[model samples]
Structures are given as structure tokens and as C-alpha cells.
Target: MKTTLSKIVLLSLWAATTSLFADSHGDHDWKPLFNGKTLAGWGVVQGYANYYVEDGAILGRTAEGSPNTFLTTYEKYGDFELKFEVKVDEGLNSGVQIRSHSRDFGSRR
Candidate 1:
């Protein structure tokens, strides 16, 4: 019951670092989208899952009886290489939404 998009290309990365900066390790063009400390530039556009920062990582916890939840950046991005590390517990499904629109929101509770 996770809500995600189906046709967008974007960058979604989270690291242990504490700030957004250019990659000093050769590929200076690499941009870090998260500061790795808090969810400062992200927001929940729908649903009731809980998102929070801990150990420099973003965690999503689903609440019983709640609908599928979505957390997205305040700015829109497209056509970019995406790299990320993820760990999903049993019975939990998580994914990067590639594309989305206004009509994608809400469902019967």
C-alpha cells in the first residue's frame, strides 16, 4: 500500500554526511540532496506514514489503519542519475517514485 509514481527520473540519495555539498572525490558534479541530519526540504503531500531522521538516515514508519503515505521534495527534479541505499523490513514495501501528478493523491480510507 505504498504510494509512489511511475514515470519520472530524479535524484534521491541519503548519506551519513551532515551537509549538502559538491563531491570532493573527483566527480564534483555530484550533488547531495540531503544534509543527512533532518528533513528540512521535504514534505508529506499525502497519507499518514511517519517520516523522521535518526542515525543520519530517513525512516518511514507506517501507522495501523492509515493509508499509503508519500514524502517528496519541495522542488521538482527530472532526468538525473539516482543512487541510494535502502533496507526494507519484512512486510514493508518502499520505492522511489519516478513520476507523479495531482490526480495521484487520496484513496478510500
Candidate 2:
């Protein structure tokens, strides 16, 4: 009975350790959304902001009189994981949108 209990405990420890490593270094089938040279797969909406590629980064500049604009992806996704980096000036507000949609509501009143 002692030997049997030892073997069971050892097996449990091995399984727990294996699962820890597996969860830490999970299977990540990630794909790059930006090509680092151009905005090939992106589109601009509302025409109130400007987006361009500079130094391998997509930059968005706010226009003075324009409304809120979006530089969005042309393709829609149901579930996804995204990683990004942003550097903005003081008091600048920026964000990333996921699982979103847009519709034309005619002229603004």
C-alpha cells in the first residue's frame, strides 16, 4: 500500500508539472495584421482622420474640424486575440476596437 500511494503521488506531480508548462507556453497560432510597410488590409471610415504608414508603424492624426474617424479592418472577425503598441502625446486619447461594425446613417443633422 505504501509503494502504491507513492507511485500515485508521483504520477500526480508529473501531470501537474506538465500541465503548468503546457499552459505557460501555449499553442499560439498568431498572424500579423499589419505588413509593417503599408496599410494594405485596412480601410478608413468617416474621412475625418488621416492614417498612414511611417517607419513601419501605422499613424493616425486627428484633423481639426473632422468628426470621430476610424481606421478599421476590412474583414470581420467573430473571436480573436490582438496585441498592439501605441505611443501618443500627452492628453491624446486612443484605443483599439474589436468585434465592431459600422453603418451609414445618411447626413448628420
Candidate 3:
């Protein structure tokens, strides 16, 4: 709930409906990615920021002397729907990329 680009807990589904949080996944067959208690099954790549679990949500805190960090899932998805809530400072660089293994273009990685 308080993380950056890729710190969200993903729920993959064949189809995404408006009731993504209707207290049920019977229609969409959603599968959660993150456990919400730890960073298990996730990997950090491409940047130097810090990501961790806190208060039943993931937190991605940017640090000095670091580029845009990514907390990616270990498993790959062909196609899916994602619903998330994010809180980041205005004007800070952040985004989530789906199905693309490549980093942003012109990265100083």
C-alpha cells in the first residue's frame, strides 16, 4: 500500500473486472503474488533504493545516490490484471512495467 513501482502485491487473472476487490475472486481467478508480510518470492534489480514489508504492506523508500529501484516478482506472467493503491511524493519518478524484462531505456545500469 505504501511502496513504489514494483512493490505491489499482484493478483493475476484472465480477465479484470470493476469489482477487483469485491471480497471475492470467483469470477476472475486472481492469484496474489506477494505475501504481504515479507519479500519472499521477490527480487530487487536495476536500482539502489530499499524495499521492505511494513504494516501489512510493502514500502519502497528511495535513498540518496540511487536510481529508480524495482521490486519484481520471481515468477513470470503471460497476461493478467492488476489493481493497486500507491502513495508517492508528487513529481517523484515511478512506474510499473508488465511482461517486460528489460529496464527503462538509457538506464545507467
Q: TM-score per candidate, in order?
A: 0.61, 0.59, 0.64
Clash count of each predicted structure: 2, 0, 0
* lDDT (Cα) of model 2: 0.51
Higher-lDDT candidate of 1 and 2: 1
Q: List the candidate 3 regions with Cα displacement exceeding 4 Å.
A: 1-29, 102-109
List model 1 lDDT by residue over 37-92, tens digit each: 78887776567766777666666666677765677766666545544454443455
After TM-score superposition, what is the CA distance of residue 40 in candidate 1 from its true location, in Å? Answer: 1.1
9 Cα displacement, candidate 2 (Å): 51
Q: Residues 2-90, candidate 3, lDDT per residue (tens digit)?
A: 33433432211111222333446467555566655787777778776676776656666666777666767777765565665544555
The 10-residue segment with the lowest total lDDT in model 3:
9-18
**Which candidate leads in lDDT?**
3
Candidate 2, residues 1-109, lDDT tens digits: the string is 3223323333333333233333334664444556667777777776556566655555565566767666666765544443333334444444555567777422222
User: What are the Cα lDDT values of the candidates?
Assistant: 0.53, 0.51, 0.55
Colliding residue pairs in candidate 1: 8-98, 8-99
Task: Candidate 1: list runs displaced more than 4 Å.
Answer: 1-28, 103-109
What pairs collide in candidate 2? none
